[model samples]
Target: MSGWVAVAGLGPGADELVTPEVMQALAEATDLIGYFPYVARVADRPGLVRHGSDNRVELERAAHALELAAAGKQVVVASSGDPGVFAMASALFEALEAGPAEWRLLDIRILPGITAMLAAAARAGSPLGHDFCAINLSDNLKPWALIERRLRLAAQADFAMAFYNPRSKARPEGFARALDILRQECGPDRLILFARAVSTPEEELRVVRLGDAGAEMADMRTMVILGSSHSRLIERPGSPILYTPRWTE
Candidate 1:
């Protein structure tokens, strides 16, 4: 049987949020590969083999998927959020480009799924209903100065911002520094959101002003969204609805 590789997103955490396309791909895959927790999301089946690896090994994981595909095994590389968004799609392409020439000829596909930022936005109403940007706060691959520069520019643009990988054990101070920059550029009155483990049993959402926002509210599993200056809250019986008006002056 001719082999192919499908890099798919399983969405944030809930199985119901996973896309049908990704589900079909997983069902057909002979081999599944990804980070430990993402691979664990898929159940064991009679004909399927699971390969889970540690974090920070994206390129190696991509290469392994390609190797399996070249050997006539239908492989699926799973990612937590949209594969194309801060996930495995870019890594897979990077590996393919630097790999043997024949690897490019293999059939490869990317399947999209709901990203954490969107999931968080939905839970909070529509803070991102207007123009916004998604930024990965981890400096694992980039410089801290670059991240600071981007944060300043985004604040100046008055764009609602969604952040991924806000804080991890290795880079505990980065998110604190990020909060400082935002407070300086956007001021303390700006709204900041911490959406932790959205759609999962551990899900928690917190909305606070920049003045009150703290670094401890976020971790690897959390997604942070900072509202534009025009964003406002609508008081309700339960949690308030946060949204930015679609019109601009």
Candidate 2:
């Protein structure tokens, strides 16, 4: 059997959002490895061995994928949104770097998919039309101080910002602190968007000024975007358009 490992992105929620390249990899996979929820996304079929694991053991999962591939199994590691965006791609590389030298020779591929940030931006006009930065707000891998520092510096530089993992039951207060920091730097009138479950049936999109924006507005599934000082809204009879012009003074 030809052995290889593919780190594939499942895209944001919807089945249609998954890329054809990733779909092909899934179709050919003899073994599927991923977080439990993402593994559940693929339909069960003959000859496909699904290995669903916990959400936090990314590195272990990556090592397992490499091991399976080394043993001549066609393995696909699944990640929601883009695998490179706070997902399994980086973990796969990390494992490869530290594992046996032979692991490096395995056919490893990273497949791109539509991340939640881009999907959320498309749903609510173009909040990321200009220069923007995407940050993962969960402090599980890093320090909260670092997250706050990045938030402050990004605000100072006037970059439209996208935040992921904004809030969770385990760390609910971090997002509230993030809100306080944003208010201090960007002030009350800055436009912020709370887009939850971007392409799914449970999708919810709400735009609010910073002053009125609450921490409770976001959750793990929500993608939060904060417009720069230069961002503008074109209010119409019905829905509004939020975008940042390409040219800045």
Candidate 3:
């Protein structure tokens, strides 16, 4: 059988958020490769072989997928959110570029799914309804100074922002520093959101002012959103709905 590789997004958490295309890819995959938790999200089937690796081994995992595909195995690399957004698709391509020339000729596909930012935004009204930018707060691959620079520029641009990989055990201080920067640049009244485990049973959503926002509000499972100067909250009977009005003066 000819070999192919599909980098598929499982969405934030809910199985229902997974797209039909991704589901089909998963069903047809002969081998599934991803971080341990993401790989475990798939069910065990008779013909499928699952390979789970540590979270830090993305490049290694991508290389393995390519090697498997080169040997005529249908491989799927699973990612929790959209594979293109702070996920495996970029790593897969990076590996492909550095691998054997023949690897470039393989049938590689990226199947999109509901990203965490969008899922969280939907659940918390339309906070991203206007112009926005998404940033990965983790400085694992990039420099912390670069992240800070980008954060300042994004704040200056007055664009609503979504942050992925906000805080983790090893790099707990980054998000706290991020909050400090935003509080300085965007001021105390700016709106911020913490959406944890979005679209899952354990999902939690909180909206707070920038001054009141704390790094402890987020973990690796959390997605953070900061509103542009134009964003505002509408008070309802229960919880308020936060949204960015489309019109700009």
Q: Compared to the true structure, candidate 2 yields what TM-score?
A: 0.98
Candidate 1 global lDDT: 0.95
* CA shift of 23, model 1, Å: 0.6
Q: Relative to the unseen true structure, what is the C-alpha lDDT of residue 187 in candidate 2, on a scale of 0 to 100?
A: 99
Model 3 over residues 187-218: C-alpha lDDT tens digits? 99999989999998999999999999999999
Model 3: number of clashes?
Answer: 0
Candidate 1 per-residue C-alpha lDDT over 38-100 given as tens digits, one digit per residue, 9 for 90 to 100: 999998999999999999999999999999999999999999889999999999999999999
Candidate 1 minimal-lDDT segment of 10 residues: 240-249
Q: What is the lDDT of residue 47 in candidate 3?
A: 97
| lDDT, residue 209, candidate 3 | 98
TM-score of each: 0.99, 0.98, 0.98
Cα-based lDDT for every prediction: 0.95, 0.95, 0.95
